[model samples]
Target: MFRISSVCLCLFASLAIADESSKPGRLTVAQKNGWATYDTELKKKEDAVNKACGSAVKSSYDRSTYPAFDPMKDRTQSACQMAVGTLVEVCRTPDGKAAVKEAVTKTVCRLSTEGTKVSLDGSVLTIHIDPEKSSIVGKEPGSYSWKSALEEVL
Candidate 1:
């Protein structure tokens, strides 16, 4: 009975971890937007790869020396290119572009950065909220503002 209980507990623990891992990373509204951008880029690259290497290209290979060439290798490399390390979305600067520029220089990141657009840093891809451009206006009354959501996070 003891052995069976221990095994069941272990199995449940592993299952829980697997389930959590399968879920998308938790993010603020701005972060979700940034992640969507990255996702779009990934899809674009995947589409390009599929177009270029979805089918094996004809190669001149001697029957005796080399019977086959692997187009899968090229396809695999292109598919791998779709992966970007991590994405961070910085809080929007409501004060305007000048404030955003100043904040970018002062903001510190815990992680190392390959590219930074604004407050986001220490990741392969980073984006900061651009108040003027990165907004959605709705004709209907009482639309939620991304800036307000971002302010709470920041």
Candidate 2:
């Protein structure tokens, strides 16, 4: 099933995400830094991610083990996700790398999917969403999200 495959991908990707934010400086690379991105396309891809999460959360109503929904615990990840490619490339923004590193150390937390009945644990933020399923899906045993290396190019 597409869901299962995606789940696996998310999990494997998690190993990468956990270590990425630690790069020398900012997670976002600037053109001057020789880090480039396909901004328009990245926007579209990020949009897709956003749309999938929003739609999935809207449709994800069936509950199994997590008990009745709590808005705080079960809010949709639509906001955290970007539409850029699920697979992202990373590099430090020349000037902000140090600041970004510090912020991530202080701010990062264990992640989980909000709407998916599948309790993914690889990331605090869900990586890929199935609109048809209206759920956040991922791989690995805990924390659901894409690798940090992937987050930079956008």
Candidate 3:
């Protein structure tokens, strides 16, 4: 009888959690505008980095060879690292730095509504979103804004 009661309680608790998560997440007008701006800036930066890296890789390959140069072997990983380096370089500039700070601040403010914790140790930046008490982790090196913000918050 006790075992059956415990099982029912566990089931009810799980259902309640699921119901909460199923509800849509809402953002204010300011947050929506901020997110749009961030999205556009992010896309522009990504395109620049990708174009630079792609050109470098293509030029490095010998297209004249009989066997078409296959750059896919571990190229993606290397390209990604190069892109990160490029992003870091961009972040070092005054304008880039300011953009990053503004983006981070806006993002943190939006996420704060759902409870967010941000931390940066060396190159790794960890963000914990407490909507459902789940954590998302990402690592990037030499992001000054990340370091500064983390220091200020934590």
When superposed on Cα atoms, how far off is each prediction in RMSD? 19.0, 21.3, 17.6
Error of 2 at 64 (Å): 31
Instruction: Kindly list the per-residue Cα lDDT of model 2 for residues 1-154, writing each as its tens digit.
Output: 9999999999989977877644444332332222122223334544443343231111121222223323334332342233223322211343233322222211111123344322223322223334334533344334444433233311
Candidate 1 lDDT tens digits, 80-133: 221211111221223432322232222211111232122323311222322223
Report the Cα lDDT for candidate 1.
0.32
Ten residues in a row with the worst lDDT in model 2?
Answer: 102-111
- What's the TM for model 2? 0.19
10 residues in a row with least lDDT, candidate 1: 57-66
TM-score ranking of the models = 3, 1, 2
lDDT of 1 at 70: 33
Candidate 1 backbone collisions, by pair? 112-122, 113-122
**TM of each candidate vs. truth:** 0.22, 0.19, 0.26
Q: How much lDDT does each candidate structure score?
A: 0.32, 0.33, 0.38
lDDT (tens digit, per residue) of candidate 3 on 12-69: 9999999987665455575455445544544454455334323111112111221221
